[model samples]
Target: MKITQIEIYAIHLPLIEPFIISYDRYDTMPSIIVKMTTDTGVIGYGESVPDDHVTGESWESTYAVLKHQLAPAVIGQNPMEFEKIHEVMNKVIRDVPAAKAAIDIACFDIAGKTLQVPVYQLIGGRFHKKFPITHVLSIGSPEKMANEAAEHVEMGYRSFKMKVGTEVMKDVERIKAVRERVGADIAIRVDVNQGWVNASTTLRGLRAMRDLDIDWLEQPVKADDIDAMVEIKSKADVSLMIDEGLHGVKEMREIIAKRAADKVNIKLMKCGGIYPAMKLAVMAEMAGIECQVGSMVESSVGSAAGFHVAFSKKNMTSVELTGPLKFSKDIGDLHYEVPFIELNEKPGLGVTVDEAILEELCKFKDVVKEG
Candidate 1:
């Protein structure tokens, strides 16, 4: 089928608590959603994590990128021709891969619907009913963070992800407190978000974290310093999963070849859509790198796409698609009102948006376009 139309929306879903990181504070998540319609009556959906902080996308930028850069290339092309679309997107906007990725996700959704299969099947993963979800614990005093972890666990969550990147000793002290509170056996991982001091300190800190059973340390150093990353990887005993170091298939292969990291956290926005996501997974598999699917702060529409991608990867080492749980409110019917994002057995992503809710909770009415 051929594409007939494209629709974009700037969505803002408020978080229960302000999600903070070294980069920015996210009180309300903003994202660009793309919906494409084909001649044969199939509709595919996609979401983009804008470049800026707080949903990382603004309406103006999203529209300009979509209408002028991304949409133009894919308007009339066949959805099956993902390579051509990928090339077109990359050719037009070399660095803004997130915008290109949004359209790519919609194309993949359309492809799966047309082929009468779930998106995961196309990527070679069996459709499991539910995947274990890990809650995100913000950086705070060890006591406060531990309490939060305990609360989620009391609510039935068994896994926890903690944010670090502050001071090294302080980070270690907090992890120690959390480990003491949780009393071991629960999988705990630390996401430093590139907080380590330098290559030397990173090696020293990682050696300590390894002894603590950190499970994984994500992007412990600056993303660009692969040499530093490799040095840290060489010294650390725990698994080092690279988040910022991985972009797409090209960088994925490079990281594996260089041994810069042992695993990767594949964000939907980072990979740009399921097409590259699947491509990256295949590339990772060939190179022996385990993949983990993750998300930006998104409502169910965007979050479910990530879930499917994560569920479909056979070599999925760990997951971080817990955006829905961390946020205070969700904006659509695409999700069940539960603490965790549960997977369904329906066809084609298995969820739908509540337009009325979108109208009330979303920032942009329908399309993310220029004035």
Candidate 2:
């Protein structure tokens, strides 16, 4: 069946609290949702939660590209032709992976629904029925961060990711306090978001936290600085995981060749969508690199897409799709068993989108159909 109409909606979801990292603070998350209707009377949903610092996309830009360029490019195409659809989108526009991701995700949703199988089944059968999710703590004072870690521990979360990269000494203090409060059994990962700025500063921060038992340090330096990553990896005792540095398989190959990082964080928006994400996971597996499926603080529509990827791949050892937990309201149905995200066997993304809530939350809406 061919795609006939595409609907785009821009919505702002209020965060439960301010999500502060090294470079920015977010009190609300802006997301773009896509609805694709097909000739066979099948409808599919997708989401794009772009971060300017990561994907270099914002709500306005993502919405604009979807309405004016990407959506129209995919009209009259078969939703099952993932590669052709991607090629068409790339020809119309370039470097807007988040915008392309919305269409790609909707295609997968359609493919799964048409085939009457879950999205994971379409990729690879489920390897994990349920897995523990990593709870992320925004940047805060030492005591505040420690208290938050303790609170999550009481909630049955065993893994935590802490935001760092503001100040070397204070960042060390933040990790130390959380480690002490949560004890030794709980795993803790640190993300700098390239806040340290240079290899020297990152080495200094790493030295300060040498005794804290960090599971891994993520993107300590800037995204484009492979030399800095190599230097940091050579000097630091902790494992390095690249986040912003990796977008697709090409970056993955370069990192492997340079020995820059021990792991990679794969976000759907960064590499386009599940189609490319699966390719990245397979490439990581072939290269013997561990992968983590990360989120852009999306609602259930996007998080469910991530969940399907995470559950199907064994090399995706870590999961950070906790965005749904941070939002005060969402438009799709996703169940969280405290520390674990459980998936259903229903077709497609297995998510039920509340259209009324979506309409209420939408600040901008547009429909692209054949003229």
Candidate 3:
């Protein structure tokens, strides 16, 4: 079927607690939501979490690009021709990955609906019905962080991710406290968000975490410093996972060639959409690199797309789609069991937005009619 209408919503959902990373702090999740309706009466939904520090996108810019560039490009085209839609979007602009991602997700949703199958089946089919989730601990003092880890552990979570890259000594202490609080047999990982800027500092941090049983250290040094990462990876006892450094296939290939990291993390916002996300994941998988699917502060509609892509791959080592858990509201119905996120059996993403809630949280709205 052909596309007939596209609607955009600018929504802001306040987080349960402030989410702190190396670059900044987030008190609310400012997102762009897309709804595309086809002539045959099928509607597909998508969401884009705009973070200037991550994807170089903002809520206002994402909305503008989707409205003035992407929506017009895809309105008359057949949703089934996914490649053609991409071709149209690419020709219109460059570097707006978050904007492109929203349209791409909506198209994939429509594709699954038209084919009468789940998006996972349309992509690579499900390898596991449920996947383990890694809950991230916000940056805080050693004692507070340890308490947070204990709370998740009491809830039956076996895996946790801690935010690091602060003072090396404090980071080390934070790791020690969490490990002690959680006890043995639990998986722990840390992400620096590119906080350690120099090779020496990164090496020091890695050395401090050497005996902590960290599953991996993520983006410790500056994202562009591949030589430093390679040096640290060569020397460190812990394995390394590249996050901010991985942009697309080209960057992934460069990191692979340099032997810069042992694993790669793929997020829909960073890589553009599920299409590019799957491409990078499969490409890394073939090269023997483990993959992890993650998300920004997205609603359920966006995280559901990430869920399908994560389960569709055989080499996905872990997931960090716990964005919904940090917020009190979500667009889709989801079931969470400690470490596992259960998917609904319905087709095509199987998530819907509450209009009343949408209107309540939405700061702006627009409709782009097919011409």
Ranking by lDDT: 2, 3, 1
lDDT per residue, candidate 2, 1-371, as tens digits? 99999999999988999999999999998999999999999999999988899999988989998998999889999999999999998899888988888998999999999999999998998998788988999999999999999998998999999999897888999999999999999999999999998899999888887888989999989898988999988887899999999998789889888988889999999999999999999988888889999988999999999999999998988889988899888899888988888899999999999999899899989999976
Q: TM-scores of the models, in the given order?
A: 0.90, 0.99, 0.97
Q: Please say which candidate is ahead in TM-score: 2 or 3.
A: 2
1-371 per-residue lDDT for model 1 (tens digits): 77777887667777788886656667777767777888788988777766453224555677678876678667777876888888878887776667876788788778878888877766775645566777888778789998888877778777788888888878888888888778778878888877884678767676566657777888888766777878877776778888876777677767877988888888777767777777887788787888888777666666777778877767775667766665666654455434455666566666575566656665653432222
Runs of candidate 1 with Cα error greater than 4 angstroms are 51-60, 125-129, 207-211, 334-342, 365-371
Backbone Cα, N, C clashes tallied per candidate: 5, 0, 0
Each model's C-alpha lDDT? 0.73, 0.92, 0.85
TM-score winner: 2
Best by lDDT: 2
What are the RMSDs of all candidates, in order? Answer: 2.9, 0.9, 1.2
> Where is the poorest 10-residue window by lDDT in model 3?
330-339
The lDDT, on a scale of 0 to 1, for candidate 2 is 0.92
Which pairs clash (backbone N, Cα, C closer than 3 Å) in model 1?
15-328, 16-328, 50-56, 52-56, 101-272
